[model samples]
Target: MKTFKLNPYRIGFRTIKTAAGMAIGVIIAKQLGVINFSSAAILVVLCVKNTKMKSMQAAWARFASCLMGLIFASLVFELLGYYPVVLGLIVLLFIPATVVIGTQEGVVTACVIILHCFNSKGVSLDFILNEILLIIIGLSIALLLNLFMPNRSRELEDYKTNIEQEFQLILSEFSEALKYVDIKLDHRMIAHVQLTIEKAKSVAFMDVENHFGRNDNSYYHYFTMRGEQALLLYRMVGLINNVSRSDQLHQQLSELIHEMSQNISGHDHTAIRLHDLYAIQLQLKDHQLPTSYEAFHSRASAFQLLHELENYLHIKSKFGSLKK
Candidate 1:
């Protein structure tokens, strides 16, 4: 038999925020003298989300559905009589109604409101106002708490640093692989770089979602640029690993890649790199035709590698221009 153990240190900021938000919502609702004041806490629990847009969306859906639910319940229950069967009918009809209106996120909350309506025995303006107040109190507290999410920019920056370092290491390895055919590239490191970029992109996207008013996010753009470069790097790795032997051209490209690896960062060095790449391309054009099939294949791979490198720099160049 396996025993389950909880890692107490696993609690995160969201947990803390939710707990505090629930308490505040309940207290405020009770102070407002609203019936079923604790439902406000439930609303807070349901509405808080990892991103501001999601939280806002949940809150809006819940609020809208709750209102619609109340209206549907008040009419159907008052007219059809508040029987248990009537309650069931309301749940049946109201769910589909909410779905039709695209407020399905609030279906649970709406059901809660329906129960309140059923228990009231009759629908009155005062009763409807009370439910509205409860929703406002709960959802407002949730939105407020969600607004205090910890800044993830620092974490994103750390991911950026890790990704750049990994790229540097990978490129340095590529340079070595060029000079020595027997050198084996670390597939594990390549995998790690891909994983890191994905994680960073996730964080960057979350950062973008956190800012409701901002149309542009630099971190997102940075990760996107890195993601494109990573694809190029993966292709280059395969090409470099297949190179038959080192020659003057191969050595020159290797030296250039080494320099590029040294300068990998958020800064724009694409213009300089592109100039050097063009020089290398020009040199490639001046070389005599390969006499052997292996030499031809190697030269072909070198040309592809050079093209990939040029594209990699162009991606950064475009990104830099956009940033300006």
Candidate 2:
């Protein structure tokens, strides 16, 4: 039998925020004399999502859905008379209404509200007031807690550094592979780069959400450029893997790759890199064509590599301009 090992010290910020929000909501609801204080806690648990924008959106949806449920319950239980059959009818109508209003995220919360009405057997003015107060307490606490998110710009910068480091490593590996055939390439590096880019994009989006008036699209543009570069890098790696021998052309390409890796963090090296890449293209054009099938394939791979290198340089240049 395998024993389950759990890390007791590892808790995420989201978990902490949700827990704090729930405690606060429940306390406030009880102090305000809400009979069903647990509903406030439930709302907190459901409303506190990953990002501030998401949390706010969820809160609004839940509030709307709860209101709809309250209205339906008031009519069904008061007019139709409280019964299990009436509760069934409410569910049948409520589900479609929530879906139509685009508040499906609050479906469970809506059901909870409807259940509260059923338990009371009817919707009294006090019960409706209590439900409204609970909604206010729960959503207010969740929104306030979510607003306390840490500075995500720092996290985005860290992601940028990590992604650049990975790119440098991959480029260095590519340079080495250009010079020798025995060096095995780790194809996983491209996958890692792809994953890091996605994470960076997500963090950047969160950063955007944290600020209300900031119109900076630099992070979004930066991640998009990186994503495009990753695709090019993937193709370059595939092309490099086909080369089996080092000649003057391969040596020059290796030097170019090394230079690129060294300047991965630089701001304005794109022009210089583009110049060098153009020079390499000219050299490849002037070089003698291969006669053997293997040589022809190697030469074709080299051309493809240079083409991708040119594209990568252009993307870097575009990214730098965005920063300015």
Candidate 3:
């Protein structure tokens, strides 16, 4: 809320900067008695658009765009203004149309140019000056309103939570992905893999964007951790896919998953089912005994290994070690 209220003023300040342009405009406009208020109002957005370089980029972009627009608009409108109503309305319409420009620089420049076109008259020299004064008023109001808004950091945290939840949603799809693969290991399997991969990458990007402001090391570390977690899931899926397609289920892969699941679900190491999965993997790999997925499924093991693995993997990735 505070940022919201202050945002308007910041925008106005940007506008005022453009209109005044090193204090000369403000001094001259105030002195000449041709000051305008909206000048500063538009500059704020230009600065905001360049906020990627930590607000400095925005400031420069805003000022440069605004000034260039003003210069161009002033010249064009001067020639066209012989027909005041048509020229004035056209200029007015053009100014606001720039509102949807989607970038700070574009919007600010458009704003200034439009203002020049709309307000230009015998007071061409005073146009920028007048705008500079109006900028102060708009900025001040925005500043005052935004003074006590809610904590922006907290809002960022909420966004972070949402991103994490979206990541989890991808994780939840894994079992479905597996079951689908079990039915037919076709191109559809690749589609699920791509979806999960993209979703994980997006989560990593969001975390990077929202986690650290300018501190590079911490930001990299956080993202690196997330990448590691994502890779683990990728590894797990690869293991499961192999089981579904292999002529004979691979023993090591099955044993690893079986042990990992037991570790995940907090199931007893001695549980009959967990032991049986290990035994099944060993027997199948060696062609020693029972030779089917159905036989493995029919046994009433003490705990479901796959379920335990999924839950544990999710918990470990999203949170800290469950061992604690």
Evaluate residue 98 in candidate 1 and report its C-alpha lDDT on the 0 to 100 scale: 81
TM-score to native of every candidate shown? 0.92, 0.92, 0.41
Clashing pairs in 2: none
Candidate 1 regions off by >4 Å? 1-9, 266-268, 321-324
Candidate 2: which stretches are off by over 4 Å?
A: 7-9, 214-217, 244-246, 321-324
Clashes of each: 0, 0, 19
Candidate 1: clashing pairs of residues:
none
Off by over 4 Å in 3: 1-59, 76-104, 133-251, 258-324
TM-score of 3: 0.41
How well is each residue in 194-274 modelled by candidate 1, as lDDT tens digits? 889998888888888899898668988888888889888988877887666644578888988998998886445767888
What is the C-alpha local distance difference test score of each model?
A: 0.87, 0.85, 0.43
lDDT of 1: 0.87
Q: What is the lDDT of residue 297 in candidate 1?
A: 86
